[model samples]
Target: MRDQTDTGTTEPIPSRLLLGYARVSTDDQDLTNQRAELHEAGCTKIFSEKITGTRRDRPELARMLDHLRPGDIVTVTRLDRLARSTRDLLDIAEHIQSGGAGLRSLAEPWADTTTPAGRMVMTVFAGIAEFERSLIVERTRSGRVAAKARGVKFGPRPTL
Candidate 1:
């Protein structure tokens, strides 16, 4: 009689787990739609939370990241739900990649990190987002300068 380990390697097959992450900016927003989409996409596990994406300390997101493993894929309904800025997205992507896991966005097909083309697209998107932020900052600074020249006080008004 041949033992199972004698016929093949002792290591078991690595399962490809799809982990979903869903978020809402505020308590009033519902995660139902995101959850439904993730479920339909075949996510075996899901992590969700209601918090501003700008905050650095997101417990659910942290938990999801910690739970990730090799051969796992982190799925999000949209890019905005996962991150508030390009830097944040890049950081999250780095963490996912470091763990040997992949990232995928349902709304943005090009944001997937499992393929070479997808990785290139994500880099391009990050650059675009950064450029857009810089433009907004420059415009805001110009507006501030114009307002200052017009003698508009920016601080709190004097006592009534």
Candidate 2:
């Protein structure tokens, strides 16, 4: 008769438990849905932030990063919640990758750094973000030039 269970001959599926991070710019935004989504996505632990993403200090995000260990996975409902700027997003991604962890974005289904295609997508996003920044800089310059042409002061006025 064959044994019903394996005699310690089976391999584990590499515990890929998900860790969730959620953020909202203002208190007005509801976090109920975000928490539910993270739970549904298999998040054993969820870290939430209620402050603006533009701020240099995000206590929840900081705590999440510190808590993460190698071979773990971090998830977010959307990328914007994690980072507001392209540079910030890229920085965070790099940090996660360095820690031997992967990032998954629920909203951006294509953003799964665990696959080759996902890495490609991230590279493309970096390029697009750089282009967007350049365009903004150019537009600002043009606007300033137009304003000056209309006799608008660029700086504080001199006292008489």
Q: Best TM-score goes to which candidate?
A: 2
* lDDT digits (tens) for residues 79-159 of candidate 2: 999987778998898899898888989999898887889889988988998899899999999999999999898777888
lDDT by residue (38-133, candidate 1, tens digit) is 999999999999999989999999999999999899999999999988878988998999999999999999899998998998788778878998
lDDT of 1: 0.92
Error of 1 at 106 (Å): 0.5
Per-candidate TM-score against the hidden true structure: 0.72, 0.73
> Clashing pairs in model 2?
none
State each model's CA lDDT, in order.
0.92, 0.88
- Location of the lowest summed lDDT over 10 successive residues in candidate 1: 1-10
